[model samples]
Structures are given as C-alpha cells and as structure tokens.
Target: MKKIAVIYWTGTGNTEAMAHSVADGARTAGAEVAIQCVGDIAADTAAGFDALALGCPAMGAEVLEETEFEPFFAELEPQLGGKTVGLFGSYGWGDGQWMRDWKERTIAAGANLCGEPVMANEAPGVTELDECRALGEALTK
Candidate 1:
C-alpha cells in the first residue's frame, strides 16, 4: 500500500485538526497514513513517504511558523522534487498569501501538487476541513 505522511505544526491547533482530517481521508482512500507533528518527525523520514500533506499556520507577517516549521520545511524542500505534496494551513490575518507563496515554492522545488492548497482564516470550519480531506485523497492518487 502507498505510505503517506501527514505532517504539521500548529500554534492554535487549527492546522493540527486539518492534519487529522487529511490523514483520515488518506486512510479512507486505502493508503497507509502516518500523522505526525513537525517536531516529532525528521525531514528525511517524512521525505521518504510516497506522498506528503504538510500543514503549518501562518505566523509573523503572514509567513510560515518561523522556529520549527520553516527550518523543517527548508530541510525537506530539497527532497521534494518529483514528489506528490499537498499543502494546508490556517491564517488569522492576511489574504492567504502564505499558502499562495508556499504553493509557488513547492512548485519551484519540482514537487507535484495534488490540488489547490487548503487554508482557513482562523479555525477551519467544515468546508475547509473537507477540502483538506480532498487534498489528502488527491495525494493518494
């Protein structure tokens, strides 16, 4: 079975909730899913997955969480070429620019995005979570 990693870092648990839904969707779609916090997993280990769903809430001027997620993502980015990746996050402010920039970065890294990145304003409501799930399912494809 395909092995997928649902990795994330969350300040307010918004992105964590999205990560669970992403993993659930992947499991439902018949893939083996490992859901983990960014601090708990190594970038190289996560990069070994058949597909990836990455989440981190927007922080400090609409950028990724600086301390943990950014460094982890930077380490993981080089391994993403030709990998299937899905991006999701929550933003309390700004116009979801973080997600857009993240998408561009992922593309520039040569990662094959599963679909549009999923974003929520504060906490993800039902729609955004469902979209996250769909993003997960797409990764399994």
Candidate 2:
C-alpha cells in the first residue's frame, strides 16, 4: 500500500476538518495514512511517505500560518524533490493567493504535484470535503 501523510495546522478548525476528509479518502483508496498536526511531525518524517497532503489556513495578507506551518514547511521543502504532494487549505479573505504561492513553492522544490490544490473560503462544506477527498485519492494514483 502507498504510504501517505496528511499533515496540517488549523486555526479555526476548517483546515483540520479538511485534513480528516483527505485522510478518509486516502484510507478508502487503500493507502496507509498518517494524519498529523504540523507541530507533531519532524521534517524528515515526510521522506517516509510515498505522497503528502499538506494543509494550513491562509493567514495574514494571504500567506501561510507564519509561526508553525511556515517553518515546518520550509524545513520539509528541501526534501520534497521527486515527491508527490497535494495541498489544501481554507481562506477567510483574498483570491486564493496563498495557495497560488504555495503551489509555486512546491513546484520549485521539485515536487510532483498530484492534482490542483484544494481551497475553501471558510469552513468547508460537502462539496469542498468531496474535493479534498478527491485530492487524497489522487495522491494514491
């Protein structure tokens, strides 16, 4: 089975909900999934997974959560070469600029993106949850 990690950080719990949806989908698709908070994981832990689903809320002027997620991601980025990565998040404002920037960063890090990054305006609903699931299934592909 594919080893997949669903790693994320949440402020208002929207992104945490999204992460669970992603993990559920990956599990359904027959992947071994580890769903974890960003703070609970080490950067090198990413290397053990066949694919990654990363999540964080868009914070402060359309950027990633500065304190925890950003620094964790920065450490993980350099190790992403040839890795399969999927991204999802929630945003309160802006035109999904954070996701755009994140996608660019992932590409620059040499990750093989699994699918389009998934984003929801606030709390994700049924549609957004389904999309997150699809993104997870893509990681197994």
Candidate 3:
C-alpha cells in the first residue's frame, strides 16, 4: 500500500481538523496514512513518506507558523525533490498568499503537487473540508 504522512501545526485547531480529514480521505482511498503534529515528526522521517500532506495555519503577515512548521518545512524542502506533496492551511486575513508561495516553493523543490493547494479562511467550512479530502485522495493517486 502507498504510505502517506499528514503532518501539521495548528494554533487554533483549524488546520488540525483539516489534517484529520486529509488523512481520512487518504485512508479511504486505500493508502496507509499516518497523521501527526509537526513537532512529533522529524523532517527527515516525514520526507520518507511516499506522499505528504502538510498543513499549517497562516500566522502574522500571512506566513507559515514561524517557530515549528517553518523550520521543519525548511529541513524537509531539500528532500522533496520528485516527491508527491499536498498543501493545506487556514488563514484569517489577507489573500492566500502563503499557500501560493508555498506551492511555488514546493514546485521549485521539484515536488509533484497532487492538485491545487487547499486553503480555508479561519475555520474550514464543509466545502473546504471536502476539498481537503479530495486533496488527500489525489495524493494517493
């Protein structure tokens, strides 16, 4: 079975909820899914997954969570060459510039994105959650 890692860091649990839905959809699509907080998984270990679904809510100035997620992502970025990746996050303000920048970074790293990156403003609504699930399923493919 394909193995997928759903790793996330959330300040308000919005991204965390999206992470779960991503994992659920991956599992339903017959992938072996492991979901964990960003702090719980090392970047090297997360990079070993067959596919990745990464989540982090937008922080100040519409950037990724600076402390944990950013460092982890930086470490993992070098290893993402030719890897399948999916991105998701929540933002309270600003356009989803974070997700856009993230997608560009992922592509520049040579990672194959599963689909369009998913983003929600504040808490994710049902539509956003479903889109997250679809993102997960796309990763499994």
Candidate 4:
C-alpha cells in the first residue's frame, strides 16, 4: 500500500478536523496513513511517504502560521520535487489568498499538486470535509 502522511497544525482545531477527514479518505482508498502534527514530524519525514497532505490555518494577513508551520514548510520545500502534495486549511477571514499562494509555491517547488488547495472559512462543514476527502483520494491516484 502507498504510505501517505497527513500533517497539520491547528490553533482552534478547525484544521485538525480537516486533517482527520483527509486521513479517513486515504485509509478508505487503501493507503497506509500517518497522521501527525507539524511539530511531531520533521520536514525530512515527508520524503518517506508516497504522498503528503499538509494543513495549516490562515494567520495574520492571510499567511501560514509563521512561527511553526512556515519554518517547517520551508525546510520541506526542497524535498517536494516530483512528489504528490496536497494542501488544505481553515481561514477565519480573508479571501483564501494564503491557499492560492501556497499552491503556487508548492508547484514551484516541483510538486505535482493533487488538486486545488482546500479551504474552509472557519470550522469545516460537510462540503469542506468532502473536499478534503477528495484531496486525499487524489493522492491515491
């Protein structure tokens, strides 16, 4: 089975919920899944997985969590070339500029983006959850 990692950072638990939904979809698709917080897994850990799903909520000015997720992601960026990568997150405000920027960055890093980055306004609703699942499923393809 393909080994997939679903890594995320959550402040209000909204992104965490999306992470679980992603893991569920990966599991259902017959992939071995590892779900972890960004702090628990190092940037190099991403190399071990066949595909990766990363999540982090939008922060000030619609940016990634700078103190943690950003630095971690920067470390991982160089490793993304030719890898299957999925990005998702929750936003309290703003027009999802973070996700758009993130998508572009991931592509620039040479990753084959699974799909459009999934974004939720606050806590994800059913639609968002389903989109998260689709993101996970895309990794299986």
Candidate 5:
C-alpha cells in the first residue's frame, strides 16, 4: 500500500479538519497514512511515505506560519527531492497568493506537486473538504 504523510499546523482548527478529510480520502484509495501536527513531526519520517500532504493557514501578508510550520517545512525542503507532495490550507483573505507562492517554493525545493493547491476561504464546507480528500487520493495514485 502507498504510505502517505499528512503534516499540518492549525491555529483555528480549519486546517486540522482538512487534514482528517485528506487522510480519509487517502485511506479510501488504499494508502496507509499518518497525520501529524508540525511540532509532532520528526525529521526523516517522510522517508517511508510514498506521498506527502502539507497543510497550514496563510499568515500575515500571505506568508507561512513562521513559528512552526515554515521552519519545519524549510527543514523538510532539503529532503523532498523526488517526492510527491500535495498542498492545502485555509485563508481568511487575500488573493490566494500564499498557496501560489507555496506552490512555487515547493517546486523549487524539489518536490513535485501532485495537483493544484487545495484551499478554502475560511473553514471548509462539505464541498471543499471533499476536494481535499480527492486530492489525497490523487496524490497517492
């Protein structure tokens, strides 16, 4: 089975909720999955996973949360060569630049995005959550 890792950091539970849905979809497609918060993640854990799902909310000026998620992901960037990755997040405002910039950063860091970034304006409703799951399945396949 394909093993996937979902790493996220949520301040208001929106991204965390999305992470669960992503894991659900990955499992539905027969992939083994581990969902973890950024602080809980151990370096090199992605070594065993076939795909990666990364989640974080867009911070001020459409930047990544620097305290935890950014640093963790920055550390992860080095090890992501040849890895399949999916990006997801919730944004309160702006033009979704965070996702776009994040996509660019991930690509530059050597991780191939499985598909377009999944994002919601605030908390995800059913439709957005469904899309997140679909993204997970697609990433594994």
Candidate 6:
C-alpha cells in the first residue's frame, strides 16, 4: 500500500477534524496512513511517504502558524522534489487567502498538489468533509 502522511497543527480542533476525514479517505483508497501533528513528525522523515497532507489553520493576520507549522513546512518544503502533496486547513475569517498562498508555495517547492487546497471556514461540514476525503483518496493515485 502507498504510505501517506497527514501532518497538521491545530489550535482549536477544527483542523484536526479535517485530518481525520482525510485519513478515512486515504484508507478507503488503499493507502497506509500516518496522522500526526507537525510537532510530532520527524524533521527528516519525508522520504518514507509517497504522499503528504499538510494542515495548519490560518493564524494571525492570515498566515500559517509561524513558530511551529511554518517552520516545519519550511524544513519539509526544501525536499519535496517529487512528492504528491495535499494541503488543507480551517480558517476563522477572510477568503481563504492563506490556503491560496500556501498552495502557491507548495508548487514552488516542487511538489505536485492533488488539487486546490481543501478548506473550511471553521470545521469540516458535510460537504467539506466529503471534499477532504476525496483529496485523500486522490493522493493515492
């Protein structure tokens, strides 16, 4: 089975909810998955997974969590040369500009995105959850 990692950082459990949906989808698509907070993920552990799902809620002034998630991504970004990557997150306000910027950055890092980043305003609702699951299943292919 393809090994896929779901790495995320959540302040209020919204993004965590989405992460679970993603894992469920990946499992349905026959991918072995590892789900963890970015803090728990090893800095040098990118090579073992065929696909990666990164999550971080929008933080102050519409940016990724600078201290943890951003830095973790910065470390991982440098080496995503040929990885299948998916991005997801929750946002409190604004028009999902953070996910947009993040998607652009992912492209710049040489990763192939499964699709446009999946996002929800606060938590994954019924439709959002389905989309998140589809994102996970697509990562396997």
Ten residues in a row with the worst lDDT in model 3? 56-65
Evaluate model 1: give its TM-score. 0.98
Candidate achieving higher lDDT, 1 or 6:
1
**Per-model root-mean-square deviation over C-alphas:** 0.6, 0.7, 0.6, 0.7, 1.0, 0.9
Backbone clashes counted, model 6:
0
- Kindly provide the TM-score of model 5 when superposed on the true structure, using C-alpha atoms: 0.96
Q: lDDT for model 5, please.
A: 0.90
- Clashing pairs counted in every model: 0, 0, 0, 0, 0, 0
- TM-score, one value per model: 0.98, 0.98, 0.98, 0.98, 0.96, 0.97
Write down the RMSD of candidate 3 (Cα, Å): 0.6
Candidate 3 stretches with Cα past 4 Å from truth are: none
lDDT of 3: 0.94
Clashing pairs in 3: none
* Model 6 misplaced regions, further than 4 Å: none
User: Per-residue lDDT for 62 in model 2?
Assistant: 87
Residue-level lDDT of model 6, residues 1-141, one tens digit each, is: 899999999999999999999999999999999999988887579546899998899998889999889888888888887889999999987898888899998999899999878999997899989988999999989
The local distance difference test score of model 2 is 0.94
| Count: clashes, candidate 3 | 0
Residues 47-70 of candidate 5 have per-residue lDDT tens digits of: 457889999999978999989988
User: Residue 94 in candidate 5 has what lDDT?
Assistant: 85
Assess the local accuracy of residue 98 in candidate 6 as a C-alpha lDDT between 0 and 100: 89
lDDT of each: 0.93, 0.94, 0.94, 0.93, 0.90, 0.90
